[model samples]
Target: MTRILFLFIDGVGLGPDSPENPLSTLDLPSFRALAGRQPWTSRSETIDRPDHVFRPIDATLGLEGLPQSGTGQATLLTGENAARIHGRHFGPYPPTTVRPTVQDKSVFAQLAPLIGTDRLAFANAYPERFFQHVEARGRWTVTTLAARSAGVRLRREADVRDGIAIPADLTGRTWQRLFDADAEPISEAEAARRLVALLDDHTFVLHEYYLTDKAGHSQDPARAASVLESLDRLFAGVLEAAGPDDVLLITSDHGNIEDLGTKSHTRHPVPLVAWGAGADAFSSCRSLLDVTPTIVELLTR
Candidate 1:
């Protein structure tokens, strides 16, 4: 079976060759191996490789202002120009205007007919507090809203306890320290195994890693370095465990942490990396709006 492990590393972009950029600061072996070199900075960026595909899609979708998580993520997941629809870049959370688009066009929604609802997995687990917040505030991230709209079960605390789901962080550090949840911190290898395990039951698996975006907003060099290193370690483990049939696809909505010069998102192009039998199927995508369509075509074909 051709299963996909969609690793959505938030707030990353093809950054420039600057000291503040993690690409210039950290040693990322997994990324290096995939690209056959280090991640390209704007001073030295490339596109269209056999194993890796780096495309600079317009996050803004021709709307003005810096790209944001709400619109950018909605566009990435649903193939809709969310920012343009809203007439402005809108947030950490998606705006109400584009909520319908996300619900309708997310990959989860589009692939439901072909893959079946039972076989698509939103592999990230939420803490009790998160559930409580959503219940009270009626708020949801673009990814969560997309999955829920498609009738997919969002992984919960029990999923984490059963070693079947990953926390927002690859390791369960925050879960162990911040919550009363019995989950303990695991090694990167364990995390990778849990992610790969989803392939047994799922045709499409989505795992969100928001620390990259968080690190970008934090503007702390040390934190940025730490997050990048940890992410690369997890990527290495997943790469080692993934089977030949498992297509590993990594991408982001917008660039932020890649260049810590500011505390906001950058207009730089996002990274779309896919490796497996149908890796080249994604090469034609020119905008963020093309991602879900490309994946839907490949998975259904």
Candidate 2:
């Protein structure tokens, strides 16, 4: 069987203003369609389908203060309580001591050998400038470090230029350009469709969407709604195209986008939604650290 397709949405959570929450706004016909007539909420809920059921997994690690992306992601992908280990929540960037842990224990590093290179893929293609910047500065995030350590090819411009990979937006332009051109409006459904199309060849594909955090920082309800609408459209498309055997796992590192009262991460639990073969494996998870181990268990079993 093909490995799971992991979809990581940065800084998302379940919250009120039901209509305003991006998860709620998403007209995910595919998800709802698969989930049948069951109730869906930004908070944790389970949906049963003919083939399989998708359940929401939590992302909070149970520490005080706001969750930081670096530690939160480290915990999510490594199954380690990174914030607690470091004494407090770290940053958008990982601390020096945490580097080894991220490199050695992250999902990519732990699972790559079991799954093989061709079977594993990270879908976010990088621009040429990003490569150049990283080369000069030598700074890296937990995700990048994990992928690099695992020998997973960090997607590059060629992948995008050749159409092998699509931008986070379908138009094949930089996200900045998409924002500039109100003309480039592709709904969340469309975005998900494109992602599904892109996943045809890989056993494991990971895609990251970071717009929620940006919307939270801006604290504009209109902008937040717009972001949510876009994601809803994207997921709708993915659900429509998803294969019966394919698994879609939607998760996050922290809780920044759910609450707009402050431009900071929340201690509230982040939602983890899973569909397909190994969806049940997530039932064993309770914190961020359990995610990577759960995925590994599912795929390796």
Candidate 3:
């Protein structure tokens, strides 16, 4: 079976390769080597390598406003024109009207029957407080809703400690700071190993990292670059650890971190970086809606 490791990075886009863009300022050797290019920017055209591909895909979905996570993520997960269905770009969370589609047709939900729920896994570890918030407010992110809809068990801190899951921050530093727990930070290499290991028991594994978006919102160039640094290492590590049958897909909801010029999400196109087995299947992806379907096809075919 072909194993898929999907990394959903929020608020990243292909901006101008300038001082303000971390992809330009930093040396992402792994990213560069895998994609066969450096400083992926607005000027970057499609790169079709023998083993991988790197390109920008439209995140706007032909909408009229800055792309927002709600509709953007829904569109990515469900492979549907969520923005049009909702009549507008909708947030940090999906609108009530759009939640049903995410729950019923997300990549996880769609793949459940074909791959079996037992073979799908969401690798990001959630803290106890997250569950408390969901219990109190009945709110959930698109990823979480999708996972639950497919009966995929959401990983927890214990899973992180057990070497079976990864933290949203890539490292456990944020978890320690937020929860005041006695935990040591793990290196990006170790996190990569843990994530890759999960494929041993499942056919598909997904992990979400959102701090890049938060850093973009902060408008702090240094902070944005720092997070990107961690991600660069994480991606490199995953590529190194993956087996012959493992395919890796890295993408984002919309553009934010790539350009710190504005605190809001940009109208820029986000990158679609694919590597290893089945990587070529995504070379033709033109928009967020194409992601889930291509991934489903990769594994099913």
Candidate 4:
């Protein structure tokens, strides 16, 4: 069977929120539907389903202070404790010291050979401007670095222009303005439909969602709520359009939006929800480092 889709949401966590906490204002129906009814004692949970197992994972790499995106994401995609190696948590970019590890050890790099060319793909399409920025700085985010190193083709403007990839605003909202005019909001449902269309074309498709982290940094309840709602709508659409062979895995690195008490990351654990084949294997994952290995195992099996 095809490995299906993998989604990464940045800087999300699990924690308590008071009235003053902006996170309490957001309506996360899909998240709440999965997590609210259950009691989360640790950073992870395994909800048993007939055909699949749903698991929530911890994103923090067992460190003190808030987990930063740089280290957290590196660990999530590479299965290495980037924060511990750097001596402390880092920022939005992977430290130069970890470049070799990220280049050689990430999921994309390790899994590409097994999946074959065009089978493993990164679905996020970058505009010409973003490519120019990366070219000038010679810098890459953990996701971009991992995918590029693994030999996965980075989605480009041509992909968007030719209807090969979908933008983050698969629902056709405000975010679409960032892209060129040829882009259209296909609605969340249609976006999922298109994603399923690509599943047959590729074995492993990875997508990144950073809006939750952005909403948290802004510390606006209205915006955060809207983000959650849009995400929930997206999830709902994906679920509806998902095929029997399609597996959906959602995870994050560190905590930020789950508790809005501060503008920094939280000590709380991030959630890892899975559906489809091999979900049971994820129930045993304990930290961010375990993610890449788990995905590799699932795909290879």
lDDT of 4 by residue, 43-136 (tens): 3345766445555566656667778888888888888889888888887999998878899999888887787767887877776777799979
List of clashing residue pairs for candidate 4: 57-272
Error of 4 at 197 (Å): 2.3
lDDT score for residue 209 of model 3: 94
lDDT, candidate 4, at 67: 81
Q: TM-score, each model?
A: 0.96, 0.85, 0.97, 0.90
Model 1 C-alpha lDDT per residue in residues 1-301, reported as the tens digit of each score? 6788999999988877788888766777777766557564554444465555655555657877788888989999998899888889998889999999999889999999888998899989999899999989989999999999999998887888889898998888888888867887777788889899888888999999999899999999999888888888888888888887888888888889888889988988777778776677778987788889988988888
For model 2, state the Cα shift of residue 118 in Å.
Answer: 2.1
Better of 1 and 3 by TM-score: 3
Which consecutive 10 residues in model 4 have the weakest lDDT in total? 36-45
Ranking by lDDT: 3, 1, 4, 2
RMSD of 3: 1.1
lDDT of each: 0.84, 0.69, 0.89, 0.73
Scored by lDDT, the top model is: 3
CA displacement after TM-score superposition, residue 95 of candidate 3 (Å):
0.6
User: Which runs of model 1 end up more than 4 angstroms from their true locations?
Assistant: 43-52
- The root-mean-square deviation over C-alpha atoms between each candidate and the true structure, in angstroms, is 1.5, 3.5, 1.1, 2.6
